[model samples]
Structure formats: structure tokens, C-alpha cells
Target: MAQEPLLRCSGMDKSFAGVPALRDVHMSVAAGEVRALIGQNGAGKSTLIKVLTGVYRRDAGQVEFAGNPVDFTSTQDAQRNGLATIYQEVNLVPYRSVAENICIGRARRRFGLIDWKAVNAEARERLAALDVHVDVTRPLVEYPIATQQMTAIARALSFDAKLVIMDEPTSSLAEREVATLLDVIRRLRDEGVAIVFVSHRLDELYAVCDTITVLRDGRTVADSPISELSRYDLVSTMLGRELTESERRGQHVGATATAAAPTVLEARDLRRAPVLNGSSVTLRRGEVVGLAGLLGSGRSETARALFGADPVTDGEIHRDGEPVRFASPQEAIRARIGFNSEDRKGEGIIPDLSVRENITLALLPRLLRRGIVDRGRQQEIVDRFIRRLDIKLAGPDQKISELSGGNQQKVLLARWLCTDPEVLILDEPTRGIDVGAKQEIQNLVRELADDGLSVLLISSELEELITDCDRVVVLRDGATVAELEGEDISEKSMLHAMAEGTAATGSRQPSGSREEDEVHD
Candidate 1:
């Protein structure tokens, strides 16, 4: 007979403020199974995970764990009952020692005293099982991100957890680190631990998961063995439509730049310590230039340096043929340069503020009169951008936090557009949003560029860069090694440039003008 599933949730329903997050969702993971839970942002993946881990109570459902009906009151309660979660960000105290973080709740005690030696030994044993060797006595912050992630995994297993849920565990990890984490997960599955892995990376799902469950809107849409699902079908199921080839490849707004185009912004030999070595980029008027690189290749660092959010150790920035230095973001804004950061939640929005406030944030200085905000002018600007961007919000007075991820991103974009920037730098502008929203943002970006606004685009997704950018610059080891423009830009050429710098024969050499090179498609 088949073994009973390790975890089973049937007819699970959850809502917040009368808005249903999950509707009759069902998921099951058998012992020794590796299951993938995937969906776009605001798709109830988080809600279901919260309910399972006791972060929230389900409005209606039947949940059984280990052949027993369970409703955990808290994460601690769930951990004690053999369920553990490792969030995308490592949650342990940074200043705490690795050993202490691992054996935090269940520290070894002897004679009413904490047993330090036993604690360290146990932590080492747990880490060694995952092939991670580290100085357990050292603070967690001293270690790399991969080590810290392993520490989180060790802490989860230290509770003798039967079911482990990893939420975007590899989002912050490099390629090799991802492989190592996947190996550790496989080892855990072999040891009969059921795993529920949550990630947006489709490659990771195919790599580690045996079964898959797809959630769309607020309901479970697909549940099947991972091997049985094609990548195209899986994406179609999650998106509720068979994406056209044009949509999948990204549809460009037919606009191209010529050699006669004026140079708007130029960064030469930018250096900012360890992350950025010697990066250089040139943006032309009415052109979208893509910055492509692997993780840790200094894509975001370059953006920060350009925006004056971070100072560069060396380099010069020329705006419209005039050399300029911005001491801070305010100065950059004054220079008519707008930056949309990749970290949307942390750096983009003030969650407590209203949509109108967020949309007009960067323009507040211009709207100030007698040291007071000009509410009339603010509303005018906010209303105009809201209508232009088509941001879906109940009202301008609604809290920015209440909006979905896509709408919130649109608000951020609006914040920059209101400034009437000469050049806009977008770092992963469409990340973490739904497919439709992503397409909307991409189209908006193209429209903005076509309007003669110079744009510097940075994205990890190559297809996005290919379709949206007029030219692509490949960054490796903190330097721009190759440039692909016009018809030369392709997945193969970009990948070659990224892997082996300057290997792509289509790579364009530095020149005073691109007159000879005209965009074909």
C-alpha cells in the first residue's frame, strides 16, 4: 500500500479584509517527496504558506500533517510539531554566532546551564550533513550568503522537522550556491523529509522538484508530477493563457536609434570597490540600453553609482556632453536623472503613504511653496500620471501598501516620470509582477523611450533585454566586455558574451558613432 502523505490541505480557503487570497486550494506532499509551489506575485502562495506555518489562520480548510489534524497557533508551534520554514531572506540574527542561530530554541542544557560545547558540536554535525563547513562560533554576518542560507537550513532541521518549506531559497544565491542548496534538498528528501519549495525560477523547479502545484489568482490550477508537465503548458496554466511567441519573446515597440542620435548620459571607467571594478556605459537620446550580467556582476552597483545613491571611487559622468558630479540622489534629481531601484519594497515605496503621495514623492521639492506641500499641484501631477500609467487603485487616497505588487511598481515608475527626467535608469523594473503587468511595464518603458527619453535598462532576463533594448552591453566581473546592437543581439550571442567575454563575433567595438549599424527588426 502507498504511504500516507506527509501533509495534505483540502478545500483550504483564506481571506483578508474580505478579499479572498486562497479559494478552495488543495496541496499534498508525500514523505520523501519534493514538491514545488509556484505562481506570480499576489497569487496566494504566500497566504497558503502562512496558513501552513501558522502565520495566519485559514478561514476554511482541512489540513492534516503526519496523519493528524493540525492547526498551529504560531510558527514556533509548527516548528515544535515538526514543520519548519526558511524564508527567502535568512531570518536569523546577524550578530548571533552560527552555532547559536542553529541551536537557538533547543539549546543543549546541562545542570541548569547552557552547554556551549554540545551546542557547537551539534551545529557542526547538522552543517556537515549538508556539506557546509564553517566557523560555528563566528557571527553569521561574517559568512557569505550561501553559508548563511545553509545555517537557516540547519536551524530548520535542528528542530527534527519532517516537512521543510523553502521559500525562494536560491533567489539571493549564485549559480554554484544554488546547485549546492539543491543537493542538500535532495539529500533531505532521500532521508524521508518532505519538502515544499517555493520559487519563481522555473529552472530550479525542474531541477529539484518531483511534483508541482501551480496557483493562479486565489486557486490551485495545476497539480501533477513535474515530469509530466511541459514548460510551455506549465507557464500557460499558471498564466491562464497560452502565451503567444511574440509575448513570450517580448514584443518591442518598433523604435530604433541612429548614429545621429545625441548622447544623453555617459559613464566612463566607473569604479566602486569590490562589486564594481571598471564599468562603463553610454546612453543615447531616445534609446534603451540594456545592462546584462550574472548575479554579483555589479549591475545594480553600476545603477546606484550612476544615480549618485553610491559614490564611485573613480569615474566621470557626462550628461549631454557636460561633465557633472552629483553628490547625492537630490543632486541627481536636480540634474534630471531618474532611477528606479531593483529593490522595490526596501528602497522604492513608503508603505504607509497613500498612492498620491508616492506618485508625487520625487516632485515634492518643485511643488513646495513656503515650506509647505502644494496639495493642488500634487493632486494634479498624481492624477495625470495615474491616468497615464493606468495604475489600478481604488482611489488616490488608498494606501500604497494596499495595492498589488504591479500597481505599486507602477506608482514607483510614476514617481520618476513626474520629475520629467532627461535620462531614466531602471534596474529590474518588471521583477516580481504578474505576466500582464510585466508586459504593461515593458510597453510603457518602450513608449517612454520612444518619446525621446534616454533609458538605461538593467535586467537578469535576457529575453526582456533582447526585445526591449536597442543595444545590449554585457557585464562580467564588474566590467562591460562586449556590446551587441541591432540584429546582432540574441540569446546565443549574449550568453557567449556573458560566459566568455569578447567571444561573440557580433560584439561591437567602441566607436565615435553607430551610423554604419542600423536597427533591422
Candidate 2:
């Protein structure tokens, strides 16, 4: 006998503020199948998932879960109906114990009271299956971010779920932990649990997914078996670009410099207590250096420490071959250093301000005349950057919040570039933007490097770093784990060194050039 599909959705239509996010989308998954929902940022994957999960009431669609029609008005209702979702940011209580988080509201009962021992035992048993055997009674916040996410995964899967939706599940997990996660996903698939996996990592999707669904510009473009599509085809479909393999490889058509290039900035033994420990890096003039690591791996911390946005308890920093120590961002700026934070909404944008205002926000001091502001110079700077970066907007006076995510990021980049910085530290510059925007940013970064600007690039997508960077410094648990350059910067070798809890260790050599050092973490 044929088994009914665990979940199905047909003609799903969703919109926000009159903008169509999902257009007549149809998707389905049978029991025991792993389906991948993939697309560039802003491609409506999250919107469709939300519609299916009842996080948003669908404008038009038919959704069936576990052989029953459902219009889930709430996530709780969806969970009760055997549909569970695990988001990238864990939705667990930080102060609660891991066991409590996993078994809460579904606790074992005895004589009208919760069975504490049974609850802990069940939670432990489930987490143990995923190879995470932490102290179940300890507060969830006590563990690292990766461990907490694993706990959240265990809790979601333990909800008697017939259909599970994992949104960027491995974003916070290290490569080794990512391997364990794939094993758990395979076990669930074999056990007939329908899984909807959403991730940007193409390598991972090809490895674990049975079916592929590609979305572009808020429309369903392709839906087929994973075997029917190549990695190139999938990316091309998502991007609508017929880029050659070399172009896709990001071989960097930007600046070229020999080993004769000078060192613009260097950090050695960087220590910011619990977050950054003994991390070292060198930024050569006219080069892009990628900082590679999983979540909580000190990638962002290293950027912040180098930029003096965070306190550096111990480290020797040199700028232009001269010893220096930055007390704050002001000092870093004085030294011609720029930083673009990952949290764009909070740290980068001033929502109510116009595009022109946001771009010139950092240049206020330079644009002053006799203790008063100079709007003319500010507007001139804004016009140059907007035109140069090809920022799409109605006008410079338009509210920054009204622009797309990509444009907002460009505004932030312009803000730093206006300072004429010698070195730029970008943390997740391409994150949450569409592929077109991502490509533009990459090209711009390379162009700047070619013009003798040094860049410290951080991105979760290994391909982005591999394509754009001259050297990559791998971090693990708040320390430098490996340094790869030239032929050593392949995805396979990176995943090996980024493997969690391994003896991976390496450092940048004295010449500040990539070729000299080799280590395995």
C-alpha cells in the first residue's frame, strides 16, 4: 500500500505590504523523504515556511499535514498538529535547564505531578542519540551557542513531530557537529519522518537532501529529485546567471599584487578574555583575508578586537609596520581602519534617516566648517558613492528603511569608504541580501582591494570566502585553528580544519604572507 504524504501545500500565495513574497507555489513531501528548500536571500523560502507553519495566515493556499487539512493560526497549534520548526536562532529559554527545555509542557506525569526523573531521562536519551551528552540539569546558557542550538534541535524533534522544518539548521554548528547533525537527519529520514531542510550551503544540501525545490524572485522555478540537478545548475537557477565554473569559483578578477605587497595591519596573540584567545592575522595591502569559523568561533570577535570595537586584553597590533594599540573605535579610525558590523539593522542603519544622511553619518566631523555642518560636501559624498556603487533608490532623500536590504548594506559600505579607510573589516557583508546584491558587493570589495585597500572578510558561506580571499584564517572556540592559502583553501580542507573539537591549530607566519604557514586543527 502507498503511504500518504506527511505534508503538502498547493497554490500557496503570500504577500507583505502589497508585495508578493510567494506566487502560486506548490510543494510536497512524502514520509521518509528529505526535501531541500533553497534560494538566494529574499527568495520567499522563509515566507512559504511561515505560511505552512501558520506563523502567517496564507493569503491563498491549501496545506495538508499528517493527512489532515490545516490552517494553523499559531505555531503552538501547528506543533500540536505534528508540525515542528527549528529556526536558526534557538527559541529556547536561556535560564532553563536543557532537560527542562526539551521536555517542558510534554513532561512525564505521575499522580497528577510532573515526573522530574523521567523528564531528564527522556531528554538525556534523545540528546545522547545526537552525540550531545551535556549536563541536562545545567542552565542552557551555560553551554556554548552551538551546544544550545543542538539542544533546541533535540527538543523540536522530540515533539512527536510527523513533519519537521529545519531553517538554516547548521548555521551555528561547526563542521564536525554538522556531520553529527547530518547523521541525525538521516536517521530521521529512514524512520519515515518528513524533513524540510533549508540552508545556503550547497554541499550540505546535495549530501543530505533527497528532493530539491528552488525559488527565485518569489516564484517556484524548479522542483525535482536532487540527482536531476547539478550544483552549478541549482546556483544558476537561483541567481539566473549562466556563470562559468571559474566565475562561480570566485577566482577574483579584482586587484593583483605580488608577495612584495606591504602589510597594512597585523594582530598577534589577540586576547579578549572568553571570546578571543591568541588569534593572529595579517592584512596585506591590496588583498582580501577571510576569517572562517562557525558561530561562536570568534570570527566576529576577531574583527571587533582588531577594529578596537571590543576591548583587547592582550595583543600586539602593528599598523604600517609600526607598533600601535587602539583604545576605541576612534583610535582605529585615526589609524584609517573601518569596520562593518554583521548586525546591520541595529548597528548600521538609522531607520528614520534618509539615504544621504546615513551614508554621511560617519563623515560628520570631516564635513564640518567652522563648528557648523556642511550639507554640500555631505551630499557630494553621498552622490558619488550612490552612483559608484549603483545603489538603487528613488532619490538620496528617500528613507533608508524604505530601500532594499542590499541598498542599505551599500549605504553602510559608503559610510566607511567616505572615511577613505586604508583597511576595511567586513563581517557577513553579503548576508541576507539577494544574489545580485551579493555579487555586486563581492566585486566592489575586490575592486577596492585592487586599488590598494585591505579587506578582512567574514562570511558563513565558505564559497564566498574561498572565491574572494587571498588567505583564510580558520577559528574554533575563540582561537585561531588553521591558516590556509593558495591551493590549501578548498572546501574539503576547510571543513576538515573547522571540524569541532579536533586538535586543529595554526597561525599566520611573520612575513604576513600566506604561503609560509601550515597547520591542521
TM-score to native of every candidate shown: 0.68, 0.66
Question: Taking the tens digit of each residue's C-alpha lDDT, what string does model 2 give over 42-77?
Answer: 789999988888889999979987788889998888
Candidate 2 ranges beyond 4 A from true positions: 1-4, 110-112, 129-131, 244-331, 340-344, 352-420, 424-521
lDDT of each: 0.85, 0.82
Task: Give per-residue lDDT, candidate 1, residue 71.
Answer: 98
Candidate 1 CA-lDDT value:
0.85
Q: Which candidate wins on lDDT?
A: 1
Where model 1 places Cα greater than 4 Å from the true spot, the runs are 244-284, 287-335, 340-420, 425-451, 455-521
RMSD of each: 7.6, 7.5
Model 2 — which ten-residue stretch has the worst lDDT? 512-521
Best by TM-score: 1
